[model samples]
Target: MTPHSIVPRYRCWSKKLKTTLYTYPENWRAFKAQIAAQYSGARLKVASSAPAFTFGQTNRTPAFLNNFPLGKVPAFQGDDGFCLFESNAIAHYLSNEALRGSSPQAQSQVIQWVSFADSEIIPPASAWVFPTLGIMQFNKQATEQAKEEIKKVLSVLNQHLNTRTFLVGERVSLADISVACSMLWLYKQVLEPSFRQPYPNVTRWFQTCVNQPQFKAVLGEVKLCEKMAQFDPKKFADMQPKKDTATKKDTPPKKEKAAKEASKPQEKKEKKKEEKKAAPAVEEMDECEAALASEPKAKDPFAHLPKSPFVLDEFKRKYSNEDTLTVAVPHFWEHFDKEGYSIWYGEYKYPEELTMTFMSCNLIMGMFQRLDKLRKNGFASVILFGGNNDSSISGIWVFRGQDLAFTLSDDWQIDYESYSWRKLDPDTEETKTMVKEYFAWEGEFKHVGKPFNTGKCFK
Candidate 1:
């Protein structure tokens, strides 16, 4: 008897079992897995909502760690204990002959496009997309470079797809799937009508691929970006976990209740008696008052420094609301305070450790956040430089004092240690130019020898 006829029960059981995918919903990689399954005619179940499969939290569990040591998403496991991780591998495994490519040459081409998607497309695509999605800190130079890189990529794809319907062959293959998924974020988040106008062929091919039955089933109705997104600080702040400030059990009652008790004649007399007993000890300060007294006082570190007529905030407002090169920079030099405040050049000590442009921007953002106490006393334009996996952080700091404003407060101490600082002589032509360039977030950074990426303002 044939194996199918001899083992009907086993064959039926095997067909009934489905592959389980462990991944977060809305992930582009997960879309690949879903699309592959649809094309392959395989039963696939999402394990995202399973009770034991909470993202980040559950993924770190021992059980999950046993399956995926790296703890990355888009993992897969077949019914027979066959397991796989990495979105590409899982998608390739789940695909049929047509999707994987029918011939050896076709398969090799598919692999070529997949690698191209990862290397040529993803880095720049991510730099542009993640900021718009509020997933990463935005850098202007980085974003612009990414835009240029994307334009080049789209130009290549546009030329290739001029007559052909798909990437590798006439039929939809893994190459199409891989490249489409890579472009998904850009199309959905940053590629608005005008920005995508240059690549009509690419746009047509992308829309066609996404509209196919398998792609549609997995991606649903794909919404193209309406407007190019700008980074919003509030959105970034909202993503961070809020600190818990619950009151302690040992904390005293509210001041209103204490005042109410003191208002009572009987309680007033009792309080006076207690105070008399403790009079010998210098009258004890109220616990709250004592706590408040113990807190570090904010003093103007520039009190001893000379005062100038320049108003930093007024200039900052003009700089922000008007054109930088035309209005703000001119206004800055016209009213700069040399003796009252000092300009300093600050550079990150460990530029070698800096990887991922956005994360490096975050390091600057975190510094600014921690330096909130110095907002009134300091103004800075810290810019991130270079591309992904290779970058530097440097900025011009204008402080209320001759020394670093961070030195005046313990609260600002957290991030300043990472940087090496040098005071700039404000009277020099070079210092004037540096202040103008850094403040306006433009001009060549000759000292760093890297293109400016993005900048944060500490105001």
Candidate 2:
């Protein structure tokens, strides 16, 4: 029999299996597993609060650590004594075959998207959203980079979901659950309407999933971000451990109080000195993190350049919200400022080294993420022009300066060297035709010998 038709070894692929979940209240990670249980009709009793499970105290206990070696939350304990750690694992175990995927190929695709959520989505989502929640420090550079990374990921997802409702198999699989939960914080805290306007597909899919009865059972009445959250110094400071202000109230005589005050100034000075000495060791855990919790000072590389009449942000909006060929392309030429800005053609030098189409796309995505800082002053349309093992990477890049903008900062230098770059003359009709083709992603370029596989826009 084929994998899809094959019967399971066990007669009972028990959807309603009894289990207990250990985690803190309102954890997005735990929500997936709980929501999976809701889908599968699994009996999952969550131990989120005191008398059931205390987060720091209970997780550190020997009993808890034995089941979850890492002492991680959302740990599952089955009625049959089977235990599972990691939110994804628990969610998968709790999911019915339909949610996990019925066939082998379907199952693999489910895992692929789950891995995407963990690797591609969660890291950047955490970096950007945690600081806003006062859960972590915020660094402007890191947060900006994280925003770019998330946008690229969303762009990929947006295109994938453009033609469908769900991530895989046209059903609400673990992939959708995992990815949505991973992005919960971003949606709730930072992905405001203005910010998320570009990725309409992602937003639609996310809203559809969350509004489902099963999902709402776990994550009740989801709210989209209206205002983008900023890192609050006071909020972060409040999260810090409060000092032991509760002191002994032993009644001392008036004379004793007078004597203590007389010596209090000297004692306070010594204590302050000790605090000054110890503060750096504790506070300087991560330089980037400290900056994230507080404002960091850095000069913009594009600050010294003369202001161009062409507004990059306005063009980005046009390209994202309106038709590229009809509106954005026409707008670009009308406000063309060749002296202040330059268009460049970049092609990957090592085509033979490229293998999978996904990997090639990732290489483009990675380059785009690294060039996050460039988003403010640049735009690019990087495309992969083949399938499977045979593919090539090429892109059209627009930057604020006449020279290569990568040389302006150390941060932008990472991926530019891997590609061969040649400045395109804006005045030439050849350049104008190329811009229209690349910007719209529709042209018969006899130069590149492969069909267009996939493309990513960097704005």
Candidate 3:
């Protein structure tokens, strides 16, 4: 049976409902809604392949994007045409009152832990586990850092689960389900016996959650990691792009060879130009694409704009090496070009939707990475403030032109529209104070109520 096949218990508390979920097979994000449906009996049908859905192809279609603006799964659509994206939101919608919480405080607590699962557990887990599964390449420092963060998360969960079977209240709720699902790959990939032994409480809680009939029906029997898995060079190599392995055909006849040779110069010239234009497409490739594009020598997007006296590189160095409030702020204002550069303030339009601190930070990081070609012309200090479920992301950007720089290139458009951008006047004390807070990563902001939780810089 499919992971999302409806549970036998059809005595759903709500009216009989029909809905479809789109995702790839065995995707833990989709599993949240599926497993919740197992308990709530919501009849959450899944379409993961072929005619109903295909990962990259179906998701990119205009029809899908119309319903799900981000084109991300696991997207959900009710038979009534209600649409939802973001796995957590979709899962919450499918969960029953019992699974959601017994009371208001319980509901808040449940969502809190759910946010905890996303913000705390998943980032480090993926960093360590993806490499082991050959889904990503590994770096020793990153792996070690992931291990430490995992240990810290497990310790927190261990203490919390020591006296209780579930994350919130007395019984299974979205909190327990979300946390267990978040840890699923960790248990399956790298948290072997010895490594996991220190967090017996977390292990016990995980086992208890997974063994439930609801989880079992959706996830099957999850096998714990027997021996810690390591990245295999062979598997990683195999995932890399391979040339046409079919044997080359024999040499063509003299006439055919001459015809092909005659087309070579233009073909080579066109191919070279194609590579230059395609440089920014790497942003859409994968997470590692950003790393691979570390020094992508693309055509400068700001080439049409006149040179600015405000040197972005020198300011970046000043911010990096010296005190931000003293050196960087002074350097910025001293060289501030009212006509040559423009300041803009941007905030995520969907603050209520941001549940993961790391995920929020990644939005900043991803935008920075994708804007690689814009580096010669722009700088931004994007910040994520407050904690999970109650956070907001805002940034201060300096661009070479008066208008929004993202508008200059289609490749840079992926993340810009998600934010509401406003041009800021650099001369105002308000703008200078905002710049200091964001640049120095200090001081209070009346907007967010306090300091930022994390921040990223696009230099």
Candidate 4:
């Protein structure tokens, strides 16, 4: 059996700090609260500071590094020598029984809502509040955009909560616990009066969760605090320099004078003409098609080629393109573990390829799927294309030796070597850029550009 630690047996070394639990004094404090409650059955060994450790600062002492190399809090080390990052995964492992659910449908619903909470709620919430709180310094326009997007997502969640009392089944589950903790991070500081006024259901649900006995046991009285109304990016930019500020102060006035002397209303006409004359973006699909004339390199993650262990060529040769594209790929049967992860790919059916637009939509959906709590051990997949409708590619990809991907590896590397596989980065800007490229691809093919359509695959 694979090495696994139940919630009761986890938390070998760290001690729980109860005073700051679940209260959004800070992100770490809120997360600590959830982890402590989830594994309340376990005996904690040591205590650490809470709510005071700021990101990119503090929490980097030698004591902290012994647990998580990244110095990220909410990380745990088990008596069995297992350690891991990512809060959702740690919390799930700790609350093993409460998280899995009592029934199959209930389990699926739990995972679904947990995922919905993470992807839909957390992103916009962070984007909207961080800048306002001075944690992140963002421009006014950028801050406003983030707030608006957050409001839209909150509206969606509010509507969903209108009928359901909890996120998943009637009783509270890990879905509610994890999601409520995430929401509580900003509930006091970010969810301003006006936004809460319209989303009464969300407000009520949040309040009820906080009032629960278990919740209150870990987190005491909630505080009503006002956060900064606006953020100035220049504030952070200015934080690093005093002398540099003097130098910059000397330059803007001269630039303003120069700009005033060079500008006129008539120049607006010339600027518009110049904008029209700008060259269009070089078409990437055209490049791919042109490149395909020669032997294509295995750089594209979507390209159908053979790699070791999971042999793409063998699978392709074993089944015709039509069959391979349509058939559901097999699963590991057991859920993903620290040893590895999984990815699922699909090609556009009729065109026998994918357009950039649909290709991006597919990648986005895959990204969201990987965000599921059950799939938390590894990073998300990379989706790319071979060419336009004439040809395209898609695959479930994982880096070798990664928690999720490592488990899926055969050690022999035989099957994977048969496929044209390229290593992909989970954290690079290029990855997102490639996804956007796929989504923005326009061509003779129209249907391949449709919005993403999601599918269900059980392992």
Candidate 5:
């Protein structure tokens, strides 16, 4: 059944108890629900504050499971026995006619901006923010790409807000509350002045939204990020639980080991001390000998390929700093080698799972990070096409050998299995067009029939 069908009408209950919200204390979804309740003059209570529910353990009980089958956080159960899940739906039910749009068109616009916040803003914001919060593992390449994508999203919002104060109407609405709450972590944790300077309109609108009386009540004294936070390896390591190091059943008891140590003769202790002085020299020799024997023995894949005049680093520098069509594309063709290297087109195997543009872009960034070893011998421009819930991923790859680079090394094989690859003939017009379009980061992809939302470069 559809989600809306299960959400009973707000007018169905004449007498309503304080809505019980089940979520973590700092959950953004729950924050959205709280703001909506404040705006609509509705009573809401935290489930953890009530006697019946504990934060983690209570949510997993059979009784709680019967009420909310999914058992996801930010769930709601009204005093009238009505239930709802999904933050957006709960927020909508809590809102009154004024917060929700007054007219049909306005309501549709409100929904559009809410969808935009979910599909465009949240993915990249989470990628950049979660690592700093120690929620996800950090990777340098993925973080950089996420920052760039966030800039684009903010630019769009900046332009739109330049003409209008609120996202949909003259005053605060559910749209403003939803979008601002989605961006709460980003503004408070990562969007420092220097990084956000370009989008002054977005910054102003965000500040205005948070400063509203309703918003201030939910998110008190919002603090803008003074400096962008970076990933801390120590924090990431500390979050992981320590492994159990107790001795196994096959190991000897600690008491037997202690008794053996006490049994050593006093005279032999002095002799052992003398031997210990000489033992360091012997151990140093053994370490050196072991180092030579145990050194990495894997052969370099690029060793077999003949070296060409094309330097990947130089081309990348030109591609990045100069005009792609005029300078970079020309340089790439001039150094193109038909025999020593090959070009391939790669497509994601499961387009159905790609629901957001920023997330699709992250998938590409993650793949590039896993393929770091290929930086010296390979280059690629993978692009995310279309909008939210209807998108595809494809890229053009240049490898040092005729075969795919992933086949050359196991290090590059992590994410390659998720994509289908086809070797393109460099001599064909189609191949040349694909290379120029993908590398230049512009051109109508007629085959996909979707605009390029974002792209990532490997190398």
Candidate 6:
């Protein structure tokens, strides 16, 4: 007799349903497996889908449109017209208690982390991986920008999972499920063991999530793709003209000396000429092709930073009011924490909106950057909030090392109009305990739901 696999009680929900999974063959397999084994034997069915609509897929068939007017694939139609898109959402609907938990809080926590997976994890990972894999054009500027952003996001996740085994309310939740599935292809196709060295916690968490019977069922018999294309610039050199070779005898002594001296000045002149000539071409191209197609050079900005003891005090007084998000935020970032301590940059949001939205986002980004300074005693974060009242605006700014509580004091909050800033309970023993844990980690930490939001940073 064939032994029947016993479904774990937590995942034994969503039973007796003719759940048609409208998805690409490559995408739907894993979801099908989880349902077949745990739920009431969901039949695996593939829908003819086009590419780049989502995940390199184009048009979703009319059948999908009838089921889900949005036309998103990996979509599921329950027997009761419960139509859903987004793989994680579909997986949750089909899993035990929708793969969140039986409890109300558990469910909320699941949703929270799942949102993080979609909003935080996927953005950077996909941005870096897709282009590198040749699934998208390997634009140097775009890829580097994506990699840097992804690294920062990954670091945040890494710090969060430092001690915790699972995200949200322990065990498995939709959060893990979603991120795991989204990352499935990258790990199999490109994120080789060597590449995973710094991200041990993420690797471990990913492996554990995929090891679930449901995950195995959905992602059956997949082969890892070849190493992803290196986003290095040397690879793109072929797109440019080769330098002319010079014979030894043709080189003159005076010419060589003059050439050496003139090379620096002449190159600058040539570069200006090239820029003028290339301006039109640049305007025509939507993507950055040859823009700085070289490895990023590390500069020690912190080296020459002014060590003036009055910088912080002056900054605090200069822009004490954050009520109106202004250019002051960037001004503060450009001025604060001198003495080679930290660096700041900008992060443009997708589907760009108004200035206020970017301002709110920038403030949060600054707060997170400040957290990094506390860890290393290197720098602080200062972001001015901007954008229109309805849109998301932001700045990715940093200041060299400073105390977190001191920099984000009540005065600063009032000035920044950071209505969302919440102080950790200074008197509470639990707060003290967690603070100890966070400081112990040397600043790389996140406190889950209670994580502070500066309304400017990317926490």
Best by TM-score: 3
Error of 4 at 412 (Å): 34
Error of 1 at 355 (Å): 18
lDDT of 3 by residue, 11-116 (tens): 4648366899998667787888898888887878899767998665677678899999766678999889999988899889998888888789999999889888
TM-scores vs. true structure, each candidate: 0.56, 0.54, 0.62, 0.45, 0.57, 0.45
Candidate 5 has a TM-score of: 0.57
lDDT of candidate 1 over 110-225, digit per residue (tens): 98888778767876886677655544445565567689889989999999999887888667788988999989978987899998998899998888888887788888888898
lDDT of 4 by residue, 1-459 (tens): 211111123323233332221111234323533544544454433233344443323334565566566444455555565665566666655554545466888888777766766655665565555555433334333345456766776788789899977777565677777777767646766666765778888777777766666566566655544543455455333221122123455669889678667876668888897556332211111111112212222222222323334433233222222222223122221222222323322242334434543344433443333222222122222233334344333444433243234224222132223234445453454443432332223222332343322211111
lDDT of 5 by residue, 59-147 (tens): 65788879886455689988888999888999998888877888999999989988888767876776688668654456455567789
Off by over 4 Å in 6: 1-11, 28-64, 79-82, 221-228, 231-389, 392-459
Query: Alpha carbon lDDT of residue 145, candidate 2?
Result: 67
TM-score (C-alpha, index-matched) for candidate 6: 0.45
Better of 1 and 6 by TM-score: 1
lDDT values for all models: 0.72, 0.76, 0.76, 0.45, 0.74, 0.46
Q: Give me the runs in candidate 4 sitting further than 4 Å from their true place.
A: 1-25, 29-40, 45-47, 50-71, 224-228, 232-459
Which portions of model 3 show Cα errors greater than 4 Å?
1-11, 243-359, 365-412, 416-459
lDDT of 5 at 427: 88
Output the better candidate (4/6) by lDDT: 6
lDDT of 6 by residue, 406-429 (tens): 343321332233322333333455
Off by over 4 Å in 5: 1-15, 49-52, 248-459
Report RMSD for candidate 6.
Answer: 16.7
Predicted candidate 2: what Cα RMSD to the true structure?
14.7
